[model samples]
Target: MSKIYVLDTNVLLQDPYSIFSFEDNEVVIPAVVLEEVDSKKRYMDEIGRNARHVSRLIDGLRASGKLHEKIPLDNGGTIRIELNHRSFHELQDIFVEKTNDNRILAVAKNLHLEEETKEKGKRVILVSKDALVRVKADAIGLEAEDFLNDRVVEMDSLYTGFLEVYIPLDMLSRFYEKGELFLSDISKLPFYPNQFLIMKDVMGSSASAIGIVDKTKVKVKKMTFNQEHVWGIHPRNVQQTMAIELLLRKDIPLVTLIGKAGTGKTLLALAAGLMQTEDFHEYKKLLVARPIVPVGKDLGFLPGEKQEKLRPWMQPIFDNLEYLFNTKKPGELDAILAGMGSIEVEALTYIRGRSLPKQFIIIDEAQNLTKHEVKTIITRVGEDSKIVLMGDPEQIDHPYLDAYNNGLTYVVEKFKNEVVSGHVKLMKGERSGLARLAADLL
Candidate 1:
């Protein structure tokens, strides 16, 4: 049975090509959705880019046939610009407002009623990204769903970049003796490139070792910083140890760290960047940046010059740096950075359109970025540069991005098999006991 899906403006803005995702179904675009999209097309962000793309896509489709009627899609589905649904009396009695969401709901409700009266009644579904809109549709006896075409994977089943293997004591001994073990020696366990492994004894012994899968072999290795710490911070957990290894390794140019609050993802990245750029002189400079995503409220209307206005947004980065540099008072870290002349902190917005070379770049709070934003950041890395992306996927503030579809997880999944890339999911929080408890229970 063919279903008729009424798309909301957010669905179109989230994915410009979502009209073709429904195979053999009918896609209806309410005129209100187009109006809402038009209102957003003038902005200069990712949302605006998508809005413009959706408009151009619809315009290109007009060449084939009229959108107000029905235009056939290549995937055996049909799309139509639904302009006839101007008002619905049934919705006014329930919603009591003529908002865009209510208007969209009215169109879906009307279509659902009309389909129910047909000899072969077709299903009418409202597709939207907003939870309230979907809930309202359900209240009005209409089926509704979220736009899932862009979702990469579920949260529970997400890749964690590490696995545990219990093997015979002799195998562990051989691994420790030979310094490495091939996958064939370990029962052909599935392993991704640069994935960390905790090899334990299966014979009820207390023997355990940490290893990392680089090529086809797993090499037994310890943490990078033992005698000397990265700045003043030390690895308090195995996950942090693994993160430091990935961060300091010159072979892995791209590294990603996923964790919850207080998991030390950004701290470890910053520490490694400082070590590589300042102490080791492996890179020319240490560049730290993060996306300017608003959490509860936006900061556009603040009063200041650009740098002064960005102070609050970048305060978290400064806090981490202050802790690392042991800056006791305000402006202390600034003087130190000015004296070093090897550190630059900027926003991701202004970093675009520049080729950065010989720099250790760290992009914190990476979960708020989309796949395109991640691509833009990675493409800007010039020769002899390393980029570390750290974020808590569960703490996403972006309206359109989620744990599975955000740029952090996208890059983690995409680069799992590459040699030059490494990923680590920090399972333990080392910030403080209270913070760790809040991260888990709260």
Candidate 2:
């Protein structure tokens, strides 16, 4: 018995081809959904762009037949636009306001009632990413589900990509002597690709060791980089670990880092990039750039060149660079940057129509981007170019995004399964002890 899945507008906006994701099930799009999609199609951001895509997809479907009449999709789902299911009386009690959501809920209720009458015994569920909508749907005795298809993983099951397990002193000695130990040697050890392990002596005799496992192939002694301690930052936290993994790993080509504020995601990436690009010379240049978003308020325009216009957003990166370079005067770092010119910090608006090759690219504050925007950034990568996208998913300041549906979350979730990608949830704040306490408490 195929179930009927009524999609909310957000699901389609988040994913233009969400109709095909159901796979052989009956997909219902309330007439209100089309109206919402039409309203959003004219905007320029990801939502608006996705709205246009959904419009094109629906138009392509119409070439086969009318959407109100069942149209078979390529992925074995039948899509139907339901314009006739609206009734004000069904939802007038709780949702007195005639919002689009209320109208869609009315359609879902009617569809559920019809299934009950027909004795099909099939499940009818309303899927939405909005918490209030889900609550309202369940309040009316209709089944409701959050649009969790875009989540990276369940709350507790999010990929950590590494783990530290305690072992007995004797076991640690045996492991050091043998050079390798089977996973079964430890009863409860969770690990992922390129994960590091710290073996502390159980009885504490200043005997400890650290090693990294290369996806279960070989375990090698963990070589400490001077840069790790140069900045006085610890990589034990998950975000730092993720940043180090992306910056240090030579095999993986794509890496994305996401977390809230004070996670040290950007600092870690910059430090690691400097190590790989300048110290190691792994790439031709260490290109650092981020979209020139304003801080607090946009100061209209500046009187000088493009560099002047970008000073506000790029200043944070420069501040980090100044700290790394240990510059005495404020303008000294600028002179150094002018001399190298290799590290470019132009706005993302200009990167279009350009191909970057043999460079380590870092895009910061990426949560403000849309899926299309992120795709545009990724597609610009040339041969041998490695791009690292780091941003705080929870601190998204984008107008149309929430915690779960932001472009950053979408990228992290969608790309987690690929061999070239990895992700981790950085729960601790490493900027400062006070910052960490504020991040945790506030």
List pairs with backbone clashes in candidate 2: none
* Residue 297 in model 2: lDDT: 70
Q: What lDDT tens digits, residue by residue, belong to model 1 across residues 1-442?
A: 8999999999988889898899999999999999999999999999999999999999999988999999999999999999886667888778987999999999999889889899998999999999999999889899999999898886588788898888899988887787677766765767888888898999879998888886654543443444456777788888988888888889889999999999998888888899888889999999989898888977566787987777888889889889999889879988898899998888999988999999999999999999889999999999999999989989999999888889998898888888899888999888899999999998
After superposition, the stretches of candidate 2 with alpha carbons farther than 4 Å from their true spots are 74-77, 92-96, 112-124, 139-141, 174-191, 202-206, 215-220, 224-260, 275-282, 291-309, 327-332, 367-376, 398-427
Instruction: Name the weakest run of 10 consecutive residues (lDDT summed) in model 2.
Output: 217-226
Q: Per-residue lDDT tens digits of candidate 2, residues 31-109?
A: 8999999999989667888899998988888888888988988888798999887987877877889999999899999
Candidate 1 has its poorest 10 consecutive residues by lDDT at 219-228
Alpha-carbon lDDT of model 2: 0.75
Model 1 residue runs over 4 Å out of place are 217-228
